[model samples]
Target chain A: MIGFNTVEKLKGIVVVVGNYGSGKTEVSINLAVNRKRAGIDVRIADLDLVNPYFRTREARKPLAKLGIEVVMPAEKYLKADLPILSPVVAGLIRRPSQLTLIDAGGNDVGATVLASLADAFRKTSVQMLQVVNPYRPFTETIEGCLKMRDEIEKTSKMTIIGIIGNANMIDETAIEDIYKGYDFVKALSDESRLPLKFITAPATLLAEIDTGRFSCPVLPIERQLVPPWIKAAGLKK
Target chain B: MGKILMKGNEAIGEAAIRAGCLNYFAYPITPQSEVAEYLSRRMPEVGGVFLQGESEVAVGYMLFGAAGCGARVFTTSSSPGISLMSEAISYISAAELPAVFVNIVRGGPGLGGILPSQADYFQATKGGGHGDYRLLVLAPAGVQEAVDMVMMAFPLAEKYRNPVMILGDGLIGQMMEPVEFSDRFKSEPSNKDDWATNGMATRNRKERNLVKSLFLDAELLEEHNLVLKAKYDRMKQEEVRYEPYNIETDYRALIVSYGTMSRVCKTAIDNMKAEGVEVAMIRPQTLFPFPIKAIRAAAAKDGCQVVISVELSMGQMVEDVDRSVQGKCPVHWHGKAGGEIPTPEEVVDVVKSFIK
Candidate 1:
């Protein structure tokens, strides 16, 4: 029916990069959670120095309880506003787990952080994926997506092997939006010479969506990162 | 300006540009980084400068430098980031240089989780850094209001030659809403020829204009302090802004709040009204020059029973509400910190607890 077959194929160090507000962090978190749920030893690292809100570190307790190691800088440096990476990041990269996902920060400035760790990743099979949200600015068109992919690869010193379509507006996201985004991402994939690994849709929209229309696996997003007011509406943590 | 759906963070960025404050220097922080990201691309197009400094601390100084040169400049940061900029904020205030700062506040004390919180209320209102100075603080409640506030902040900062703050929570920064900007604030670039440290040659003067906050002599420093105090007092007399909701009716209770918390309070009040429970509310638009008189009047209205302070912090602004109430009625506080936003139902229950 759907492509767990493709998701099952995900291995080694997987890094997710995209333009700001492209929902890369959301995809990274769900990917880690899904891998762990699928009986894999998952460890996700938050390298998103570009944004502090909605990063994986915020959901540490739940992910940790699920035996998913959420790695980031130490507690003392959490609010330092400096790009201080945890020493454990290199260790995790060197010795890859069953599923090790890295949620990189947005754009070239953020991708540059991954360049220093490039040597450690050289030993392992690394799948660097660019996430595209058609609703966001740079990823909305084919040319913009291609431009972003070039910039991210140049800055991170890693080639993007695949693309992930993660398109949504918080509460207003609908099924058609996901379908529309797929065509947008497909064109990006063709032009950039990369495969679409998966596309994300909120868990609520899954039943209404025709899984057959999509060529890749659909990543059902369990909306973890939300505004405080929405958090109050029974979606806490 | 036509209505367009935009995130509050991005809208604030566009609003600043629309207001003609093009020089922006900021470090990336959650909830507010979109402002910097948007400006980074948009500023170059507008022939303006957008530079991300080493940290929030460095960005604050960059703002001072640019503003000293008579440029309309600003920066955006989150709670902990603002703490780093506090030192520069004090210096800018003392130097009497006009600059705008937006605080898309998140939970804090130290490394507090990145969720919405009003914990920085005291830090923003009472000087965060060491000095006798005040930032003209404006607390916005929603996305459109946030855009308007950022657009208005520039002129207000220039009017007083002081740092103006747009204090909003993560909710305001992250949410999406339709907004349209007008020249309602009359935000033209302020003429800085009188005191700005732009080159003396440009201003047709021989003496070099020094932009600094240092006064080594005690008497001279005291006089400078006095002059700043006079300006602040004038602001107190003329610049207080607030909104009174359901106050025209003889309500049974009054809830005082600002920023994101005020919206929650409004929802609670509306929910209660449907259940035959009417409550008045006082939402302050300006936090420093708090609407003391308006709050007092609201609290003393004919059928009002008590005043309650609703906040995203433990109770930072409650003290201000208490001072405004001035023992006229019993004052209580309800809040949630560490990113726990109180629900409208919870707020309604809290109100019922006291009244019942």
Candidate 2:
């Protein structure tokens, strides 16, 4: 059985950062949904000015149904490529909910948006987690993960306190991939001296894999950042 | 290496490298700037050249210069940026240089929204530039196919010594999927010494090669057009590729679609199947050759009553579908143009309209 108590650590001002295509947005959305499902008041700020697509705003309608507030840019500048941060993000940081999650963009360049909000973040006790998908390009190795951590820390001007393992090959993820990912992040946590808060597996695969093997909690991921066609087919993963 | 999750834009960049294309020149555009951003770092690591031109105009010429000297090169841009490159595209086509162009198309006529759209169907399949030249256009429905098509595009471009285009919508540029890079599509660099403008000393030839598209004489221009036309005709006979879905069933409606929109139609067809309404689809992998015979055959199926061109454009590809049907059945158009994609339910509803 997996311990659900470890998820309690994801409260107050929690920020998510990672390399490009490392599944940061997926982890952030699942985190918000996880906390919200647990009956905790969750509000997430979409600080992803770097990427134009697959951001938190795309899930606004569904998130609203779950009563989890999704903060994003204004309607006028919603699709524009410019970096126009909304004041509500600062407002969310100043007065956080039970769990305030900030979904930062991908990479150090994406994380640069966080540096601009340093004043808002400094006022609060923030807990940043770097989601590492070892299957991704940059964070595939321990050295690459360390380099990304340093670059993200330098650009965001915030220190990461924990790691979130999100290794998978999308729809092709297998049982071995989960084990490989867990081992990779476990080693990453040890080398970096950061806590391995949790690792994620597709919700469908949770029944097949033994959750007790993980040293940390296993967050069952229900994928939300998928193309519309996948959603239409009702394929859950 | 095992399959890794990658966005379409980055995968396209890596696919070029795997295809042995060492030169990449591009301008920043929405939905596709990641290609340049990815290649900017990856190119130097691989000891290749990645240049960000002053504009798409300059970038187009950069591709021309690189391809003229027998270098494998490519560029990625959106609709408006592609318009800026059309003139150079014409020159390259007329010059018969081998190069690749990927248009991760967005909504357009002017500066349209940055969301996915197939509105550039006419711009791509037909001549976008002012000339009698045609580009061999390939459209991919998913990220894996996008990578495969990009890898295959270089060889196809070189095979005919002409520019080849991979016509993808914005979703294909932005979406993430697991892609495995394999050696199945790899090809050796073609011998361009016969005609390339590479220095004569490199090939050690006595006669110098001149690369130019200009042919001032009327008869010479006509001859050049016929030669280009012959290559295009060969592509029609040799390069037509498409996937037929649910054709086994006596489908009442045949849907013709391509790129990201076809995936949506697939879902709609599957959904319709559950309700006992059989609808078939013909998804064109190559947009220019267009699988006209396949579409014509699919539309002429025994139970097929109507053919619909379901697209993200405002009835752009519908014209081609109409042309393919050629009065065999009642051809219809269904789509949305304001960057709003038609949902499976919406598609089901649209398909049902033509049913009973």
Specify the highest-DockQ model's number. 2
Off by over 4 Å in 2: A232-237, B183-188, B204-207
lDDT of 1 by residue, A1-237 (tens): 157655656977899998877888878888877777777888999998766556778777777777788899998766545788888999999888988999999888889999989889888889999988877655667888888988999999999999999877656777887888898888888887798999988887789999899888988888777554444112222
The Cα error of candidate 2 at residue B42, in Å, is 0.7
Model 1's DockQ?
Answer: 0.16
lDDT of 1 by residue, B1-356 (tens): 33544678988998898888878999987768788878888899878889989998899899889888888999999999999999999999998988999999988789787778899999999989888999999999988899889888898899899999999998789766556777543444546775688776778666676788999999999999999999899889988999989887768999998887888888888888998899989999999899999999888887788899999899989999999999998899999997878888898899988774
Best TM-score goes to which candidate? 2
List the RMSD of every prediction in angstroms.
5.5, 2.0
Question: What are the interface RMSDs of all the models?
Answer: 4.2, 1.1
Q: List the residue pairs that clash in candidate 1.
A: none
lDDT per residue as tens, model 2, B171-227:
999998889897543444566876688787788668888889999999999999999
